[model samples]
Target: MDPELLTIVVMNVMNTTRLVLHYFMSCETENDSVVPALLAAMETNNSRLLLAFTEQLHAVDRRYWARETSTEWWDRIVMHVWDDEQWLQNFRMRKSTFLELCAELAPALRRKDTRMRAALTVEKRVAIAVWKLATPDCYRSVAKQFGVGKSTVGAVVMQVCRAINRLLLRRTVTLGNVQEIIDGFEAMGFPNCGGAIDGTHIPILAPDHLAREYINRKGYFSMVLQALVDHRGRFTDINAGRSGKVHDAHIFQNTGLYRKLHSGTFFPDQKIPMGDVEMPIVILGDPAYPLLPWLMKPYTGKLDSSKERFNNRLSRCRMTVERAFGRLKGRWRCLFGRLDLDEENIPMVIAACCILHNICEVKGEKFPQEWSAEVERLAADFEQPDTRAIRGAQCVAIRIREALKEHFDHDSQ
Candidate 1:
C-alpha cells in the first residue's frame, strides 16, 4: 500500500474521532481518555504518538476558536452557535462535529455574540447541504454519522444551492469557460460541437393536475431535466422544465432552450454581454428532437471509415454527460424513491449534482454525462449499449431533426 494514501486514511478516521469528542467533551474526562486512546491506536514504533496526537488536537481546537470566536461559549467544544436578530441563539451540541466544522467558514455561521446580521448565511448552511445531498449515503445514516436531524439535512441542501447561486456560480463558470469547454471538444475532433444538449427524466409521485401529462414512455411519472454540455462534457447549462410526459423536443422548445436556436443564441447571455453570433451547438440524438441550424445528429453509414470512427469517437466523448447523470441518480436513493419535493426545489437539487459531477470529471468518472435525468440521471448501465428511440411528430420536430442530422453527417466527410 502507498504510505501517503494509508496516512490519509488514518488521518480521516482520527479527524472524525476528534470531531466527535468536541461535541461530547469533558475537558477533565477527555484529557484522561485522550492519552489512552492514542496509545491504544499506536503502532509498536510509536511511543511518542500519545503526546503527539494530544498536541495536535489542542492545536486544532485553538485554530477553531481563532476562526470562530464563539467556540469558547459552547457547553462542549462541539457546541453549535448561531446569530439571529442580533441576539445570542441557544448553544446546542452538534450531533455531527465534522459537519459543523465543514460549515463554519461563513462569517455569520456561528457565534456566542449572536446579533443576527443575516437570517441565513448561504455559505455555511446551503453550500454544505448541497455537498452532502450529492454524496452517496442514507440521510438517516448521514444524520447519525454527522449528528444532525434529517430535516436539517434537507434544509441545508436547499441553502447550499442558494449560497452557490449567490456566490460560486459566476466565479467558476463564465461564458469564457463555456467557450473553453467547447474548444476542448473541438480539439478532440468534434467540429462545431459547441456542446451537446439533451433532456433527462426524473421520476416523481403523482402531482395534482399534471399526473397524466407526466407519464412518459418509460411508463412512469417523471419530470424532464434538459441540460447543455460541451464537447469535453462539462455541463454549461441545464433546464429542469416540464413534466416527464412532455417529449424531449417539447421540453427543449417549451423551456426556451430551443429558443436559443431560433433567436440566434445557443448559450446563456446572462448579465455580461455575449457577442450575437449564431454559434453552432449540436445535440446528439436518437431521433427525438427537431433539427435547427445550431444542432446536429449522427449519420448512419454504409461502411465504417476514419470519419465513421470519428463520429463514433465524438459520440463517445459526448457520452460523458450521460454517464454523469447515471452516477448522480444512483448515488441518491431519495431521488429515485418517491421524490415529493416542492416543484421549485427539484431543479436546484439536479443543478447541485451536475456541479459536483463536473468536479468529479477531473478524474473522468466513466463513459460520459447521462441524459437520463428523466429516466435515470448519472446512469451507467454497462451491460446495455448506448442507444434509444426518439419521437418528433410536431412539424417543428420532424424538420429540425432530419435536416440537422443530414447537415452534420455530410459535413463529417
Candidate 2:
C-alpha cells in the first residue's frame, strides 16, 4: 500500500480500538486486564487489525432520526382547557372574555381559503397571540408547547394582532368620552385634568439601520410608547414607535394630539375656574413634556413650601399614568423583555395590547399575580426632563402650577 494510505489505516485502527476500550471500561463488570496487549498492538501500527475494526464500528454507531410529532394538542387545549376557569388561569383572561374576544375577532381572522396544511383556527390563533403576550416564552418554545412550527406561531401572532388592531383598536382606544375622563380626574382630586400623559421605553432589538437612533439615554435600544391614560388606568390615547433616543418633548410634538392641541381644536377652549384664577383644562405630565396651555408638569427646580405642595399633588396625580403602565406591562409580560421583531411591526403589536388591556378593564379583569413585580419595575422608570422649555412656556407653566398649588392648599384648609 502507498505510505499515505498505510498511515491513514493505522490511525483509523487506533481510533476504533480506543472507542471499544473506552466503551468496555464504562461497563461496571468489564475489567481493565486487556490494556497491555491493546497498547502494544497500537504501538506496532497494525493496519490489518485497524481495517477489520473499521467495518465493525461503522454499524455499531449507525444514526437514527425520528420525524417530529404533529401538534394536535393545541386545538384540544384551546377548546377544552381554555373554557375551564380553574385551568384557564394560564391564559391570563377569564373564559367568558376569551370567548368574547374570539367571537369579536372571528370574522377578521376567519380563513376559509388558505392552502396551508393543518391551519390553525381563528380561536387558536387568537389564543396563541394572547399567549405570546402573556408569557415570556420565545417563539420556538411556544411553538413546541403548542405543537406547531415556530414560523406558524409567529404568523398566527401577527395575523391575530393585526386583526385585533383593525377590529377593536379604534373603537376601544378612543378619547371620545371626554366627560368621563374629566369626571374620572375630578374624582381623583385633579379637577379639570383630562388625562395623565407620560412616555415609556419599550425595549427592542436595534435595527440594522439607524441602530444608534433607537438607543435611549439608559443605554438600551427601545421605542417610546407615549400614552395618555385615564384615572381608571386605561389608555385613552397612545403614540408609539418613536426612536428611543428622542426626548419625550420631541415625541409629544410629533403626535397628532400635540398638533390638535396646538391648533386649539382637540380640547374645548373654555377655561377651568380654580378659585379666582381661570386655567385651561389640560393633561398632566412630568417636566419632560412641554408645558402648553393644555399641558401641566411639576416644578422643575427650587421649591418653597407652596411649590413643594404643588409638586406633591402633581406627582400623586401623575402617578396614575405610571400605574396604568405597570398594569399594562404586568398583564402583558411580552413588554417586559426585548421584542425580537422588525421595528415596523412593534407599534401594531403594542396597539393591540393596549386595546386588549382596555377590554379587560371594561370587563373588570384583575392583573395577574406574576405581573405585579414587573408592574412595579415599570412604574419606577419615570422619564426625566429632556430639554429646557422655551422661556415663555416655562413662565406660563409656572403660573399654572402655582395656581393649582393654591387650589390644593385651599382644599386642605
Instruction: Mark the regions of model 1 whose C-alpha exceeds 4 Å error after superposition.
Output: 1-132, 135-140, 170-179, 267-283, 299-314, 330-336, 359-413
Query: How well is each residue in 227-281 modelled by candidate 2, as lDDT tens digits?
Result: 9988787888899899888888888988998898778677777677765567777
- In candidate 1, what are the lDDT values of residues 23-91, reduced to their tens digit? 545345536777566545543224354455555555552322312222132223323444321111111
- TM-score of each prediction: 0.54, 0.78
lDDT of 2: 0.78
**Considering summed lDDT, which 10 consecutive residues are worst modelled in model 1?**
85-94
